[model samples]
Target: MYIGLLSYSLAAIFFLVLLGVLLTDRRQDKPSRKYLLLATSISILWAGMAAFQSGKIELLFIYQTLEVLRNLFWQQFLLLVLGRSICAEDQSPIIYRAKILLYIISALMVVLIIDRHLLQFIPVLAHYIDPLLVGYLVQAVAVLVLLEQMLRNTRKDMVWAVKFFCLGLGGIYAYDFYLYSEAMLFQHVDNMLWQSRGLINALMVPVIGVAISRHPEWSSGIFLSRRVVFHTTTLLGGGIYLLVIGFGGYYVRNFGGGWGVIAQTLFMFGAIIILALILFSETLRAKLRVLINKHFFHYKYDYRDEWLRFIYVLSSFDETIPLPTRSIQAIAQIIESPGGMLWMKRDNNIYLPVARWHMAAVYDSENADTDFIKFMEEHDWVINLDEFEWNPGVYRSRGFFSLPDWLRSMQNAWLVMPLILQDKMLGFVVLTHAKNRRHNFNWEDTDLLKIACRQAASYLAQHEAAQALSEVRRFDDFNRLSTYMVHDLKNMIAQLSLIVSNAAKHKNNPLFVDDVVSTVENSVTKMNRLLSNLKDDVRGSEDKEDIDICCLIRREVDNRKRAGNTPNIELICVDEKIISTANHDRLASVISHIIQNAQDATPVSGNITIKLHKHINHAIIEIEDTGCGMDESFISTRLFRPFETTKGKSGMGIGVFEAREFLQRLGGDIEVESEMGKGTLFRLHLPLSRVK
Candidate 1:
């Protein structure tokens, strides 16, 4: 088939398809769609006429008629798409006047075609003027106007959608204008240009189709389909394949001496196979998809999918995986980064590398410079190292500190995203070059990284908070155990003090010597218990057992009386055994502490009473002292607090706190009532153990 015939047939088919698409569209009522359909229909008619021109005067007239109509429709389409009005009420004066002038030109072209005498009337141009040339000039003007309108109306985001339309239509009109201007000057069209017109028109069909496919509102629901991409790639690849084969054949035919034909044939077949393999490769296809989406599409990511994956990575509770590593991995995945290192600020104002993902080159002790940290803290910028290096002046002008040599030396460092929480920079992560090298850090990338970094910072902060809390709890436990040991030591010292006081009088008594021996033995046992509690590996468990509360109280009272203190100490209790489940030594120690406190608080003339009784399911012990009584504020506020005291340097305030804690551990509690200048009452309640 002849090239001209093939080109014209393709052009006709393309326009018909466009016409059908517009007619079937649900939004044909839209002025733009309506004008587009009209323009396409007229274009089809013009191409059909031009296909059979064959130098016939009538056919030439028909072609020029359709050209005039096609130009008019194109003008209307351009105007409507550009948001210009042609209606009488809303039309601007320039547009209204231009429309009227177009109609006048169309009428004049028809008159000139009907009568050759009309050109003769313009005496100076009678021989030079041609109606076809005049019609082409009008079409060129209309196309130029359309191009200008498109340029003025298009936005950055809309450029892709309108670019093909402007290029295709503008090429057609520009060629026509050149051909007609040459014809008007030389009295004939160039044969080569005239012949190529059909092929050029056919080539423009695909470009126009792309423009329509990318129409924002018209193709809103239809994304860049996979099939469209596959076919477009195939077409482009086929063109390149043909060009390569043609070049190789020319080389073989001219340069290959005797084996030219054979070599040419082999080379052609091999090239075909190689090209086919490249087109079919999955890796190549994936790369192509990424490239097209990155360059052609407005958005680089499916935000919903990206957000869900990010959330999953951060929220994962795998104990073996550290949170800092997970945080780095989560953000790195967004940009297909191969490796990253997370740096966190320490208490000493140093940022140290704490976690790394697939990052073997980075050292654990890597620290960010104080100047760099200060700059990031103040600006909170996502530093793209490429930009920082390439355009250092831009950063320097904005008051950014110079990039550290250590950081710039890292070969793969692409971006540094600051992890800021609550207006403070916690740290930053340094990401290596993206796995997909084509992807660049843009505004969207920076925004997403900042948001993800905040979430990660929260996780890091929470992890740090938990660690600090755990340490605090450990110290609190050790301090508490130490306080109990000191209170016990205080009791032991008091016991020995009484022994020393009565040593001279009772030194010769055998019974008193036995009592002193028992007291010394008990003190040694208590010291060993205190030492055992201090060992880190040994945790003290309460030795809970049934105890005779009545005998316990009587023994404590007798020991105090033997101490020879001036205050009169008395025990009041039922003779019956009062048994309760409790730790024996802890219970004894607590009771002794209370009795000692009462003795110390009371004056020599004051009386200290100890009372024990079983009430319902509980045993109650009350110690009343007629000494310096506590005020309500002191009892409520300072009482039971470890290290707090009213007895000057002689008192270790842990006694009452330890007493209350031990009692509460055995389902018991202590209550105190006091009045200033009167006396103080202490009550201890313990759950009674059922008799077995």
Candidate 2:
């Protein structure tokens, strides 16, 4: 009895100190602070009564009544705190429903008040049920639900202020629920646990004091965090699940004939596995998150979480789907929408379906409806299909022209957000109904959606830009390859020009005429190959064949003689036949370019020499000329550079560069020795084919 007295006395004193502090504050009286003052006053009275009536059976009614009143007052305080946290201009529907529930709890209190009188008149009512005990149990449950919602709905930033308050209130109501529930089953309360209640309430006094200190006026606002609601929901669901499972086990044990123990054990394991599955299901978690966000939050979205989710979805590295499809997903996920489709404006002024995610295909094209585009550009509003259907004036221009029949026919179509960037609508995304069908999207939801859709527009813009850049790079490569074909054609034309000029003189010489025929045949074959290459890209592959360098160089020298006999040409050969593995046409072209260049450089009185010899494993062909020789600077720097020549407009400049590049491809190289006003030596190193 002394311990109970000490516990309640301590609780009363603790609450008295908290109340005095709250009253001392000079801050203007607010709705939340008034509720706190009332709750604190009731707590002191309840504790004082319990302390005084610790050993008296006659005063038990007063202490129990005080307990019930104390619970009711605190529940009201918590509910009001929940209300004051809403910063929205309009009242949340949740607050209205909670008030209705509070009225129901008040009715329970009224019944408890008159239950004793009714029992006195009937006397047999006590046999079936105890109204006082059941009333306390049900009221405790209602208070617990309020506390849970208080924690879940309060903004995360404001959680610190309300956390201790919810905890303290939770402890008081939880103790009452347990006491009353046990009393209901046993038809009597345990004296020991009843005595312990005062100590538990006293312990919560300091916790409540801490909460009051954190918020002197309860000025913090409410916006639900998904994390808090998800965890709270899981805890509440798990408790109910265990209770149901316990009842089922009890029923099976009473009913089973010989298999009670075995059936009960198997059932428990199966229930545990099923619980695990439910806890891990992503779909269930998504639904739970959406439900909590829809009902508990004052605002439609938690901006920080939504922004982070947007970034994560847009920038995800899962590249199996294209960016357009991911753009649809990024927008769809913002509202917990099931699926959506994205349309982009093409150059032909048509809105083409670029991507779809889990949504059925829709209208193929839009006729570029001028009013539709103008309305989206002007307002930039997210049109809610349901609201537009119910009242067309909500979107301002729904009467101008009805939505396309294809869009109207979509049974699940819910929202249409124009993917507007820089005041120009790039396209629009149509979202299917969200996971939470009861979602009454408001100004804030549309505001966030407009921003998200604009961001998605910018992302798709970059995608389009990237695709265009890639196409340009391909065109640039083709243009570069076309330049090479033109250079080859110029060289062939120069060869044929030399033949025409010398044909009048060489027509009388049998050997000279035969050399002309051979040269013309080579040119025609090369011209055919070049034309085939232009028709179908060869990608630089050519067949290599063994060619005799002595004969090849002789033929080139003989061809050069057809240009003019004035620049006397001499052939110096150490080996009659020297074979090297190379493409015949390419090697022949290389030889012709070198000798022709030598002939062009030497004057009529000047001499040109073609020398062939075997050195080590290579066949060396040297073309030496005496005319206007190049200095070391030009030969080293600009000589082999393509399209660079002293010949001006007449020179293609790619001949020497192309020759050296082709020779290198066959495991050979070209070396030059030249001096200004003297002569130039062009040495070709051709690797000899292996001796059989």
lDDT of each: 0.77, 0.78
How high a TM-score does candidate 1 get? 0.47
C-alpha RMSD values across all candidates = 20.5, 21.9
Question: Judged by lDDT, which candidate is best?
Answer: 2
For model 2, how does the per-residue alpha-carbon lDDT over 1-692 read when each residue is reduced to its tens digit?
A: 98889888988998887777777765636777777788789889989999999889888777777777777777778778767666554766777787677667666666666456666765677786787788788789988998887788788887867888888878888998999999999999888888888888887876676566666474233222558657967987988998899889878877876998888888888898899999998657766877755444445467899999998889787746667778889888877898998878866566766678898756356755666666776788677888777767555534344677677888789998899989888999999998574366655677788999999999988878876786467557757978987887799888888989988988798997888888889988987876544432223337877778788888877776785555899999989889998878778877887777887788988998888898998889888999789964476446766556777756656678778888877778788878789999999989999866
Please write out the lDDT profile of model 1 over residues 385-427, one tens digit for every residue.
8888666765686678577666877778888989999989998
Clashes by residue pair, model 2: none
- Deviation from native of the Cα of residue 492 in model 1, angstroms: 24
Positional deviation of residue 45's Cα in model 1 after best superposition, in angstroms? 1.5
User: Lowest lDDT 10-mer window, candidate 1?
Assistant: 532-541
> What total of clashing residue pairs does each candidate reach?
0, 0
